[model samples]
Target chain A: MDDRLVTAGLHEPGLAVHVEDLTVSYHSKPVLWDIDFDIPPGVMAAIVGPNGAGKSTLIKSILDLVRPTAGHVTIHGLPYRDQRRKVGYVPQRSSVDWDFPTTALDVVTMGLYGQLGWLRRPGRKDKDRARAALARVGMEDYADRQISQLSGGQQQRVFIARALVQEADVYFLDEPMAGVDATTERTIVKILHGLRDAGKTVIVVHHDLQTVRTYFDWLVMLNVRVIAQGPVAETYTAENLRRAYGGQIALLDSAATLTPVD
Target chain B: MLDILSDFTLQNVMIGATLLGIISGVLGTFAVLRKQSLLGDTLSHAALPGICIGFLVAGTRSLPFILTGALLAGAAAALVVVFLTRTTRLKTDASLGIALSVFFALGIVLLTMIQNQGNAAQGGLDSFLFGQAAAILRSDLYVMGAITLTAVALVTGLWKEFKLISFDPSYARTLGLPVLALEVLLTTMIALAVVVGLQMVGVILMAAMIIAPAVAARQWTNKLGVMAALSALFGVVSGLVGSVISASATGLSTGPLIVLAASVIVVTSLVFAPETGLLPTALRVRRDKFSLKSRLVLGTIYRLAAEHGDPAYPAEQAMIDAFHRTDTSAVLSRLEQRGLVRSTAHHPEPTPHWVLTPKGLEQAQTPLDQSGETQ
Candidate 1:
């Protein structure tokens, strides 16, 4: 194992995420169209877009979960393969079968797998970190509960806890607050803020527009286009929201624009 | 069972049962984990055509040829599943159903074709339908043992990868795990287990070998590690008990006997095992619901009382106010019955101080935990 817990002093400046002309597809049908961007360190960024606007696909493309048909993604200036342990991913809640038999603690410990490398077992340190991660989300007491026993908010918290245990510099969360209870949503925002304050960049695929002001500083409003990306206060104007959800379908836009982005 | 294990025939039966048990126990865990228990059954039946084809091509009983045939057939079945899922609007379970019927029907056709030929090589062909492990040659046992060993090692080596992919494939891919390759590898290993054990355990009842123990052991544990270990132990016992019973009996098939024994274990676990067993789960559900109802009553009163100045309400004549309950009489009766409050005929107004009793408060204060909570 590398045992390089803190990469701050060792890493070079200028890049956290580098997506160059990335074009991903599902069975040859293009989902992400030539996404090109560079995210600097420590910004709490939002990929705000309408549903099926390739928000999830873009995140997956970066993780190598959904391989791009064209272009590439480099995390910490290295391929996902090279920096496997450097990037932590919090997928949509629907990604897993909650009915699976596992504890919250057990699920969070899975984050250590990338660092554990292979056949070697998770030791006391892994368990300790996993517990701490759960505590970070106020779920330490619920660590022993079956994952299925959690409410939508608690489930999202457990997943954030899992990602937290990874201790990666670049955190990508896909709709972490979707369907989450209000308390969980607030806790997730606080945790992300902490991550950003610690010099770790957190990119969230957020659906809520109302909270975008309070939740993030950097915004990338999208609607099959890069609408804007900068400080939330500067870019989250009525114009940007309109562009992301589209003005053509004002009815569809009305309901979507009201989402609590923060 | 002890006396039967002492007999030479029973002893052979015991060894065969143990080997079959091992194969099923190990492979069945993956089957259940993948939610392909029925698929295992389909592949078991699908292996028959391979056996018949193996006999046809080699003109003799060749374990390797038979196994290869079975493997190909199972692979074919899996391919069919993938193809259906990809090409059509058919859902996964629907695709699985189609694969099961098509593959099993093909096997049945092949078996009938071979039997119609009337070759002496067909003598033991029917045995494949319901295995006679006592008639198993030393070479056959060695073949099965080697395959079982390989399957076990493969599972161990890929344990983390399999768990990662099976539990959350999208995350596994993000972590740079080979999701597709791992899926294919696990499927191949499962298919091989079904192919190898089908001859000894038989086609029809072989899924029991793969699923029964895993399902049964699930009652005893919630952790994947513990469940896998218990499943293996249950499988071994199912094998051992089934073998001994068959060994001691006359004109009884070892395969059916073993399957029956394993089924017995599953039944016992389902009904009697503590904690997550069916009976316990049902009891817990009722208890939780009752508590929830009691809490709802108190919570409603608290909210309503806080909103209003006093706890008093019109007695007997009004509907359950603010309860959303259509019948106020039902609500008052239950509350009065529980002695949380009472109504007087002299006053049309209900009793004041509608506060929770000690028991009532306890139920209302219970923390709500989702069934999906992790331990």
Candidate 2:
């Protein structure tokens, strides 16, 4: 991990997603600073962090949703734009308008909208694919239901199904379990594991520290910078967690209104 | 009504109003769904200055020139909204309000100046404030129809793009969908929708045309395509109905009449439509409350019976009341009618003893089982 910390060039064939010297800022204040990591293919990895830790920023920068100050991201040994079709992204559910008059199927169909291109519409084949994706997430029964009518857990499942319809080699989920029920969390973890089993890389911006060892095989501890990266058993240590959280844990605990973590 | 068709002025007004309705209604769906209903209001208000500038430059009330000016002004207003929000700490709603008021204030000043000048050609320019549908000329109808057609064509050609951006622009951008371009396109279309209706609906009431039909239609459907179509239908109907009524009534401006009609439709839809309508939702809440009370009563009775080791042991009303805070007599009677519970005390007494029937006992176990399973 120390040797690979240097700015790696694009097309690192051994790595699924490679980011180096990735710094992102909102207006001049740096949100993510000098981030570096290489996620191996077929591993279920979690990007863990405290509040304002730039966990979401790291993923957004890698996905080109937010431009990095000075860095490059490669997906499967290629530039992200070149392999855009090979990647899938599920944003935070709260970031969208849930009352946008779309059904579960319609939202999932958007996963194929990129392939459908500019003027073309999704057809029966695309609908079937969306339906199958819904079934994969155990939400086939809700395919026709309006998105706003769905519960938080059901909404999360529909979002996952949408990403599933993309069928990319790698998937990025941003807080997929935030505000979700226990059943939903288990269902999502199972889906992530299924993706890993199918030889797909799954990256999630997760908050629950208790589920760290249980849910992910690999972990990246971030706090505007990469604290450590490797298998959860090795890199996710009490010392590293203290380094990443440390005094902030006390501050976070005091602010009980924020999501509590162990 | 027959006289209105025969009268060229009435005929022109009807056509213009109908076209504006359809265009605004179609575009308004995206506005409402995107949670940019306020943006529609802002853009329409911003178009006023454009209308004045068009009249000033052309020195005549040519529909095309006025509409072009309105379109440009409206687009500029949208840009200001984006610029203000991005550059400063002002949120979108605040920026929209600022832009709307500034542009509208400037427009009023220009309109006042134009009216003061008293040019013969500018006789009907003030009508743009509260549009005079009767003043709609044949040429104006052609212009309105053309604008409506362009709007329809653009929406049809870019249906997927619009839907994507409206629902989730960030995800669309991640997919390399050119989100900024799509956003600009939608803003421009909304501006265009506003500009085209600036004559018949008037700037003051134009936003309502854009939003009201969409709001009404949203109450009836969950599909974007259906919502758009239904909104268009509602818009068209409102326009026709408003124009007909206005033609019959003297001293009524068609713009406000059309807006009022659309508002009526929105109110009616919100109140009476199935599913999302207020009435049905209220009824469902009532029904659910009744059922919930019944479940509580039955569950309490089942518990009492279980404790006694006799399913048929009649539980006293005082005991059931202790478990439920609300009055339980209505629910008890409903349960008895359903044959789920029977009154052990045949006499009508305030403190009657009740016991669950076999069906009630079986059903009462569901809530308990559900609670256990949830854990």
Q: What interface RMSD does every candidate have?
A: 1.5, 1.1
> What are the runs in model 2 whose C-alpha is more than 4 Å off?
A1-10, A248-262, B292-375
Which lDDT tens digits does candidate 2 get at residues B1-375? 687667778888888888988899999998888889999899988888999999999989888788888888998998899999989989999999999999999999999999898788888887888777777778777777887899899999999889988888889977889888878888888888887787788888889998999999999988888999999999999999888888888878788889999999999999999988999999888887777777778888998899999999889887787778667888899989989999877355656899888988888887544633211
True contacts kept of 2: 0.87
Q: For model 1 chain A, where is the 10-residue window of minimal lDDT?
A: A4-13
The TM-score of the first chain in every model comes to 0.87, 0.91
Q: Native-vs-model 1 lDDT?
A: 0.76
Best by lDDT: 2
lDDT of 1 at A8: 29
True contacts preserved, each candidate? 0.69, 0.87
Worst 10 contiguous positions by lDDT, candidate 2 chain B:
B366-375
lDDT of candidate 2 over A1-262, digit per residue (tens): 2244345544687899999889998889999998889999999999998899999888888888888888888888778887778899999999987988889999999999989987788899999999999999999999889899999999999989989999899999999999999998989999999999999999999998777877888999999999999998788766787789978665544333342233
Residue lDDT tens for model 1, A1-262: 2444244233333678877778876666776786777778899999988877799888877777666788877677666676877788999999888978789998999888777877777799899999999999999999899998999899999999889998899999999988877877778889999999999999999987767777788888766556677788788777666776764456545644565555
lDDT for each candidate structure: 0.76, 0.87
TM-score of each: 0.81, 0.87
How far residue B96's Cα lies from its native spot in candidate 2, in Å, is 1.0
Q: For residue A86, what is the lDDT in candidate 2?
A: 87
